[model samples]
Target: MSPTGERVAMATDELQATLPPAVTVYERSVYSDGDSTFALVNDADGKRRLYVAGPAIADFDGGTVQGDGQVFPLTYGNAMALAEVFPWLEPTTAGRQSAFGFGDRIGLATPGHVRAVRDSDLVPVFAQQSIREMDRTGRSPEDVLATAIFGVFQEGYEGGFVADADHLMAREDVERTAGVGFTMFTCDPSEHVVADADSMSEEKVEAAFAQIEDSEAILDRYAGETFEAKTDGFTWSDSFSEIELKRAAVKYYEAIEFAEELYGWVAQAVDGDFDFEVSVDETETPTTHLEHALIASELDRRGVEVTSLAPRFVGSLEKGIDYIGDLNEFEADLKGHVAIAETYGPYRLSLHSGSDKFSIYPFFEEYASDYQHVKTAGTSYLEAIRVVAENDPDLYREIHAFALERFDEDKATYHVNTDLSNVPDIDDLTDDEFPKILDQDDGRQLLHITYGSVLSATDENGEFRFKDDLLGTLREYEDDHYAFLEEHLGHHVDLLTGEIED
Candidate 1:
């Protein structure tokens, strides 16, 4: 207090003076790569809580900060844009201090959300009410935050703040989240940890386990010898050792065991009470049958409540499958899996990665009533980008830069070596040519241009441009997109209650 001579004081209890209230924070497990953890923080008594996770303490500790304790160095343009978007984010140059009060969890998508959570006001009703608002009115993040705050201060929602772990891959993820006070958790059973294709068979399942064991042996050898030799002074041997390869055996064997153990632990922590859900990719190769069994068995074993069984559809069948025979077979396979989930009873089948298809609404509606929950994340975010783009082309450029940077970072994090040649030559195309490229039905072209049909330039980037130009260039199309979403997805206010009429 003596720096400016406005006040000169001495504090006997520095910690008490500097620290914020001891608010209990809740985190939900999402995807992580061991670098950061994501969670949704809600003030127990406040109205707003944020859902996102960021880096571990180690990454934050001793980290230098830029202006106002901003830990990471951001470009001037990006910083300015953020400040424009969130004025509260602008702070004095001490660099933002690390809010890594809790240790880090792994995952990618959590960090952005964590940043949002940390910087936002806590609202108690955020969890219980905002989701409904999101479902019905299709509220933006800002809108949700505002609603949550109003509810909390005005005694709106009373069930405490709720946050969902959208999709998690590991048991430790769940454990870490639970420790952080998250009550909702959803496990993703789609990732195949097996190394070889031959492990799909019963005999090969055991062989796969053996192969994993051998692989671990090889990895251990490298960890002990090669890695240590390379680093000399630094060793990640313990980290590698903690990675239980046997637990990563094919979905048929080890996945179920891992799920059982996770559910059991979660149950024990909550006094024999547990609420668990599972998610699968509808387009996963070899299907997710073994993973499904793992989920069902684990749920039964622990008697944990199964909230929702969400299946994420990846690429379109028309693109993923080559021939008519393959497409028919793929559809049959998907139907069979859905049937199995329905047969299990007490499970609600959900669909993920849903959007931009004007035709899939019927298919979604056919099962919508039968399922407990349905979600589409990227679609909404994409729409928001589009909205921003329509209002300001400069914002569109900034967002594009941000997205491309994020994509590059994602590739590096996954250790992927991408071939630029593999990417279709679209640089030569003009604005007029872009429409023709999208209209083509060739799977190869789609694969080359789109990222395995997981993301599309038209839907992602073009839509961004469309959104930027929405209010100005094509107000009609803007209204169309919004109206279409509202009509098909049902009003975003009460997603669970509202049904879109056919």
Candidate 2:
């Protein structure tokens, strides 16, 4: 053993001898909670647990604790704050690469996510959820982190993971997510991206540019500025002309300003390394080459250190579906984006609506060296519904019917195209046949957007309709759910890693 290991082992031996039989000294350290020198240890149940050894369990109140397991005052809600007990859990400056945010919107898929991530050489973001999703499902950020950590604990996954506060907009949101110990922040500027920017007239563009407070400074820095490839990782075109420069600045200045404000807030409020990203993918128009340059340059000028950026591309990246645009056109746009990354950011090109776009995986595999990240949330939800359909077809039928009704209401906040006429009449299908809904396009989109309604919907009595049945059914078949994700998301990771044969 190393010197530190030897020292820790000796201390653990000494402490384990004094501890009771119900609890064991699983870890050894000199860390103290309040009045007592305590260490995180395992219970007799084989759980990686830490409890107050002596009388301190009842009195301690630092970080939040799960009140059900009242053996000791756990700091990290259920366990002691891992960041305090373990050095690896603490946030640190990222290396050249960062993990893709595996957003577990349903809160039960992390065990499966960890399973997929363990086999690959990729960093896994285990705790990733957005503010809107939290509101829709009535989940707090603390609950999201707790569920993820519990899954990690269940699998005994010691490999480090990142907790991402995805698509954060306001200072209050940052404060709440940081309080729950999120290590990464993706600030979205979708609200600021003006509509139809790619088709804006030159007169309108010039007028918008002329009105910015720092218009002269931003213009002078890039209007006639030139750049060529400096190194290998990120490449620039032969040149960036004045026209391109003006176009980018005109299209993205307002969004840049909003991003800067939010990014600055997160950078200041966060206790450690503020892993920051800029997301502009929710707009109406596709982001162009010059627009990417403009956004990066503006952020850099404001001293915002961006770790990643998501630009809206030409295609429609819908939830729970494959890529919809022309593949060749997408390839051309992707080439320019990679070049922009080479010139502007050695940062990850974040993909926002990246759930089931299978056609694009090969391209990602080919450009794996470009330092990219793809985020997924809805596909996992669909996977959970798949579990319900397989295990309890009655509940599946009820939820599907409810989802069809809730589609219009819930889809207001999302961007997807689904014609109800295209959806099959669920009444015509037998219980055994209900599972086929998942294989169809309209059914996938309908169920995808209406997840919030189906999960949170209630009958006239105000009690949960399908929520209880869904969670219970999932609990009964939890192993099956994990297996499905292993085969499903594992395929996605494999495809991106070039592990899957063409």
Which pairs of residues collide in candidate 2? Answer: 234-342, 235-342
For model 1, residues 421-459, the per-residue Cα lDDT tens digits are 443344454433433322332312322222212222235
The deviation in Å at residue 448 for candidate 2 is 1.0
TM-score of each: 0.44, 0.84
Can you give the lDDT of residue 408 in candidate 2? Answer: 81
lDDT of 2 by residue, 6-40 (tens): 12334556666665666555342323433444454
- Looking at model 2, which ten-residue stretch has the lowest summed lDDT? 1-10
- Model 2 TM-score? 0.84
After superposition, the stretches of candidate 1 with alpha carbons farther than 4 Å from their true spots are: 1-162, 169-182, 189-192, 195-206, 209-249, 269-274, 280-304, 311-331, 405-502
Model 2, stretches more than 4 Å misplaced? 1-76, 81-95, 230-244
Q: lDDT (CA) for every model shown? A: 0.34, 0.72
